[model samples]
Target chain A: MSTTISPKNAVQVEASAEVKAVHQQMLRQQRLNRAATYAVAILLVLWILVPIYLIASMAFTTPAAVRAYPKGVLPFIPFSFETMNFFLQSEGIIPGVINSIIVAIITLVLSTLIAAPAGYATSRFLFPGRDFYRLSVLAVRAFPIVVLSIPLAVVFINLGMYDSVYSLALMHTALALPTTILVIGSVFASIPFELEEAAQVFGCTPFEAFRHVVLPLVLPGIAAAAVFTFVMSWNEVFAASILTVQNRTLPAQVLAVLGQSSEPYQFAGAFFMMIPALIFIFFIRRYLFNMWGQVSK
Target chain B: MNEEKQSTQKKRKKINWAPYWLILPSLIYLALFFIWPMFRGLGLAVYNDEAALSLQTEPSRDAATAGTLPQGTQVEILDQQGNLIPPDEAGQANVITEVWYQISAEDADGNTVEGWVSESRIRVREENEAGAPTAGSVRTRIGAGDTLTEVYSEPNENAEVAGQLEARAEVAITDQSILEIWYQVRGEDRNQTVEGWAQSRYIQVFGETNTGRIDRGNTGQFTTEYLSKMVNDRFFWPATITTFLLMILIIPVQFVLAIVMALVIQARLKGNSLFLYVFTIPLGISELAVGILWFSIFTQSGFLNSFLQTTGLINTPITFLSADTRYWIIIAIWLAEVWRATSIVMVIVVSGLQAISDEVLEAAELFGASLWQRVRHVILPMLKPSLQVALILRTILALQVFAVVIALSGGDVVTVLANETYRQYSEFRNANVAAAYAGLILLISMGSAVIYLRMIRSQEEMAA
Candidate 1:
């Protein structure tokens, strides 16, 4: 323990040296781990981004060069505007976009309209049959979605709303409703009843209190649920294809003609569908845990 | 006191009606669209129809003139007429042959009658409308081969059978030649989709007229035969096994990758949030797009082949989609699904990692634990719920895999349950079979979920 340089202190010096060696070894181990981490991180990042870049590359690659991408990792092949231009000019793109937008918006609206009140009920009320209702909502998922589409096609045709956007919206609502109710229920439950009570006590009606005090607080939950519902509706294809003939959502149309389309058109259509979804997810990255994580728990 | 108690009890009797009012619309919507359709899909299964694939018109006999039923016909399949054709005879026919289903349907006379149909006779009723109406299909290799056929380029016998049309080869008769003496027949020559001319006399021609060719009395499609057809399809089992294998293969890879990823990102390294963002961007992409993205890379002239060729790894562009290249096709599908879906695992695992309290790890480290030990013991144990959820969810998603297989292989070399479901309901026009597939997939998903629930318990909760 002594710092004095004496012959008797040689053992102390060796012990200190040994301690330094161990510390250095630990540092070296840490450095190796850090390097491994970075290597893996970079590798994973590439794994995620390369395909996206390839899809984007297809978007810009000319028809002649469309299938001409350099192998393994793509070499910087010259970009081509032909495929995207053809897809954009082909009369189907704008209508598909519009139809998809209409469907998603309607789905969002219906899901929220139905979800908000039920979520509020689940949060605020200990009413009769509440557990049964929630359980049944969960049970709706017992049927895989594609199973419903063919039969729903019959039901919708019988209803004479078979090919309409509203018909698709209704089906999408059915798909999205359970999640919406469950999530919004969680959201509303998280918000204290005291604020709404305060608002009511201050002479506001229940609806008005909800509009002012609760909704503002409920916005984040609504936003999370709405983003999920939007993505779900936008990404859905099986039912969309089954329900529509002349009018199909973008994914549905792309799937219907996927095999027959030229390489460029297929890539372009695929990339085009990706834009909204990517953007939506980007907007909701913070809520990734909220949307999927809590649902599982 | 009694009056006050009665008043309180009376107030309790006025139940809250708002909850019922709130869920009513959604419940009705689910009832109409979800539940009802599901039941109808079940009804489609085992439905009886005169126009079902392989259904026969006569109960049993050698010369009963069995007519085939259209596939996906939902009528009362009331009874199975015993062995309309002998099983051995059906086997000889090279299709599923077993007991014929008795279908009740309206006859051309609009009377309710029971007729029998065999399975193989009713393929998708081929349309009589050909692009070239003047052309026809030639029956090849019939008994005792009427006349030795000669294919000529000019549809003239003098031109000769320079081209050989092998027995059992399906060749379509080309347009009627001059004076109709020589009819041009086009079919596959050794290696190509080829066209050549043959004397019409040598081959029997069915004109593209409304009176189409005959439906051969193929074997009956019993349930066993039907399942066998589905199983025997080249793509069916592979697609199914790949779907399963992908589910199995990707999980460990994903779990390891996800854990490592979660650890790296959680390390608070420089710009780690950026790393997370880049990783999760794919979470937004649809299954179909991810497929197309990889597809653009795996096609014959796609990125992978191009790279292989450019680098002088190979002289010719490999047909990655060929049926002969089943393993490569599966690899391409696996690559797409893994690249696309691992991010989901990463997201879930990262959250689970974040949930691991710092103190637990600090304590483990104090006990001289290494990073590997800590992960093996602490982190993985804590991640069970997430792992369970992820496994159950991803495996189910894998079972439901549809567009990805289609996008990668264009369903040329692989077929999964989702593909079958769609094909059954839409292309095959059989809602019942599709429903059966749907039900099967559901059963598998539920089974996995139950397994996950049983296997993976949250250790943190237990510790608490």
Candidate 2:
């Protein structure tokens, strides 16, 4: 009886030990997986951030450092704004910036104003041709700006608006409108119809319900859409380059002379073009998903 | 109760016109700006603003002008002279010998006139007054001989050999003539019908249409000159090839990276929010900035060289952006595009992943599926719709890639479709050709969009 019991206990101990070893191995594998994931995450982060950091450094570096061989990877070893200042002082830079700002603002305002009503109509009302309108907007949104700009330039020249800020603004508005409408439509759609009905139930008219109840809630989304529109206009080089000559936007101005420009100017100009849009993007980061979410759907 | 019924009836009878009113302004604005410009843009491909070419009185540049020959004018070339147009500053003159023809044709005002016009300004075609090949105009056949006649691709003698027409080979005359010697013909070659230019003397000639009329001027109305010009431009194919190359190289990598990024965020690990923000930082960065950033990396003495040298990886900084290393330039542009544009795809994937319920993934896990299996069988299947949308968006945007190519390589070493359009419009001062490029891009965009839709829909049907 003692021999049989001892052998069984021995077998049990061996089985338990094997199970413990397997559990430990699985844990190790999980840890390695986690480590790999972190490594990948970090690598990706660095991949994006490094290039930006290098450019920003070049933008802030002295002209000499910018032109130096085997340039520094880290930022601001001897930080200087001489290159940036030189770019700013360069001919046409100031006017170019001003034009870009003005065109962006006009585009933002005009596109938002035009799109908001359409956005509301699509979201709130079950109107005839609603599907048609939405699809058309989607189609137009994807229309090549390169194609649109050439003919628009001709029309503008015929209308005597070519090479002017307003013509570009109009083109930008056309570009921004479809996106604005789609984005704002999604923004309006996200709000419950019951809220507007509640306002009406409390003795408000349809317009009053929209203006007071829906408008306040949708403002942030519209602002997000407006920011997107502004960024679009600011970064649009093709149409701006084609449409304007003397009153060139910042991108157009930079691109026109980019071939001949030195290293310092190119880096500084790139940084300058990037900063405002980045700031605007940061302000609207919370709404990034909100803007693109429905557009994709 | 009767009053309530009447009011309800009134509400039902009155149509809701408010939505139409709301959408009207945008619709009209789109019509005027979006729709109108699109039609006009496409129209610019075919319509020529320059209606007529002045018929010079003689072959000399200083010769007095005869009445204008409207574009598309059919003229009888009674005489001909070759003139040498001097080369420009770039020494890239129109290398084809300039042949001027003395011809009689109706002027712009419909009055018959005799004039000499530059051959470059006209298309040559055989007269077809009877609207049929006419009597004795049997299909032209190669003259009987032991030797085969050489068919040229272009009407010019110096053009490449397209094919050889066998002796006694029956050919259809296409009514097109050029260089006063070559006739456009379609004939059977190696059992394949080939269209090419054959020397007129090598083929049997027939009909009073024997003397082909020269198209001295383009009919300014509905011309294909711009479209042809856009296609024939030296930069056109390179731009097209580069654009497609970047698209093909960048897209799959983007989708894969984007999926990984989405998964990383979805992992909900530590600092996931920070990862999300960092991954998306490039979203707001303009393409021009992205180009410059990559240029700084790939440029000689830039960060890449600095890192390589510091690590003792290389003895000298490589010239990555030069014309000789055009492949590197393309890689640089591809990297820039992947870096800057992947954020959008990542966001879309993240949103797609969000729409997918965790229950499906958990079920797969419960079924003992591994992580790879779970992703392949569960997550990816559910992510198709979102992936389709993202693909369409990325494809259209990829076709329009411009500023990045310009910034990285000055657009001279490597060109893309959008860059060529700009060059044609601005530098060459030809809006029509630019418009032609634009029209091509638009067509490609629409075609890809349709293809994506069709492909996904078919897949869905198969599943259903």
Candidate 3:
């Protein structure tokens, strides 16, 4: 299948080879940059891992060993469930943990219910005072928790609902509500309005259109909001402390014991308080950037 | 007919109020719990004191009188016209008939002005009425220990005496201005130095006076009540105010720091991702844990002091957690907050950076734009949306900061809104007040979110 070629085509092939050589050199430099980036990434990952390791190690160790001078980098003895048991049986830890879970769950549900529809309306509608509503939410977001907690304590007392888990959950929902709305709003905005219109054209009511077209698309963002809300409620202490006594949440319980606890219990309590949040963060890692970015924007 | 048809078309586009109904639950929660309670809390702070005073008007002017003022004695005004008189002259108000005084008279060296005139000290004195016969001479004498006696006679016969008169009464000088004589004196003398202590008809050859309004035996009960009142009064209000103020200060600072860190990391500097991960490591730590960690470093014999001493930066170890230096602990916590929370901003910013198309940057580069120009024109415009979101999120979280301060200072040096709320609900068992605090926080959080959304909306419009 040998055939004669034109001189013009032959010259063009030589020029293409030269261009390819330059591109290969640039690719080599890019590869070197990527290697350096990867090395740093590994070190950064270790920095986060080490402290967590230390906390876990301390939580598992006996009090005597924890107080031992020149504390070992690793647990000297075999891991014990004693520390965990101690935490579970401590003054208010178990009840607090349970209350924290209940409050967080309630907050997640209530905030999601309240925020999703508002978020959709915010993104889709051009209603009067829409801008005003947006600004109001932002202002609320900026208000200090302390300032509100004290006054709210008084209000709760007047309402005959002091020191209840319900109060804490309500307050936590308020804390999470604005972010929830913003997150879901952005998610709703990203889905084209045309999709809803199409659903309506296919014999769906406005509510049905949203249910079929918009809900499914924004479900990921809503899930992310729910997860973040749960984490926030779980981690919160101020409102929990202000709103509860015997019915304390985990973080509030940890805070109450902060000054009085033995070193081992203190470390254990801290560890226990953080586990849920850490696990939540890990589970939501994929959506962390997307969800937060949308909510913030 | 065409115009009418167009008007009908516009009317068809009107929105139903269904969305407003959807938001009603949150609105009701906000109004009942947040908005209304805030006004109520403010009312409590301002109006609660009036309820404690007696409501009688002109019942007896004797009740309004202050204690004896020594001849030519300078008395510093404690409170005037219901306002606290400052140490400086700026606080002096016009003298009023219905005044309560807490006068402190000190010598040049600032010691209490006290002196011994005689064993039964005698000083000639005139009563408030100039023409009336002298209420004799008041004889002051030191008995045993911290006891004194004042003897005086009411020589005026024409004085309207409605109360019983007693002689040889025991009296004590309770405070600088108070002479609590146990006998009744004639007429109401609101201007007399020894007012509100006893009736003016009280006179004695030598008597000890008790001028205090409260009985010493029942002091423990009074103190407990007073403490509870103070907690309800000065402590709660100031604490709440301080918490809100600190939050306002911290939230913006934290937000700016976080945003700055995010922007710096996203600028694609050397080891950017590594720095980001390092920044984020602190976020894994609980606020209390972080507070404790920093406290260990900042306490009197902690790492900071040791470092300073070893470096010869100071002669002695500093007390970072002492009453004097606890402010530094607050600063340290702020630093810890930056370390822990900045990672959040970095993460948010990085995501935003990724969202921007590379083509825009490449186009800018093709135009031979400088780094600053590209950042100013290309990068920032794209990042505004993320910045708005970051601001709202950080502000809301920062406003609620509590555990860190409590863990670090144990409510000694710092108190925030959350701490006050905690104290009210947990320690004081005042749920109504705690709910009020929660209500304020809700308002603040919602308000900030609204602001952030509006800003982003405007920016979007501007960009368009």
Q: DockQ of all candidates, in order?
A: 0.38, 0.50, 0.25
Candidate 1 ranges beyond 4 A from true positions: A1-32, A69-77, A126-136, A198-204, B1-14, B48-239, B456-464
**Model 1: number of backbone collisions:** 25
By the TM-score metric, which is better: model 1 or model 2?
Answer: 2
Please report how far candidate 3 places residue B55 from its true position, in Å. 3.5
lDDT of 1 at A252: 81
Candidate 3 has a DockQ of 0.25
- What are the root-mean-square deviations of the candidates from the true structure over C-alphas? 16.2, 16.9, 15.6
i-RMS, every candidate?
Answer: 2.5, 1.3, 5.0
Q: Considering TM-score, which of the candidate structures 1 and 3 is the better prediction for this target?
A: 1
Error of 3 at B28 (Å): 2.2
Query: Which pairs of residues collide in candidate 2?
Result: B71-B218, B71-B219, B72-B218, B72-B219, B123-B215
lDDT of 2 by residue, B135-253 (tens): 11112234545354444444444556545533333333332232333344333324543333322332333355533322333235678888889888999999999988999999999
Q: How well does chain A score by TM in each candidate?
A: 0.84, 0.90, 0.86
Deviation in angstroms for A169 in model 1? 1.9
Off by over 4 Å in 3: A1-29, A75-78, B2-15, B49-286, B292-335, B364-385, B388-400, B413-464
Docking class of 3: acceptable
Interface RMSD of 3: 5.0
Once model 3 is optimally superposed onto the true structure by TM-score, how far is the C-alpha of residue B258 displaced, in angstroms? 5.5
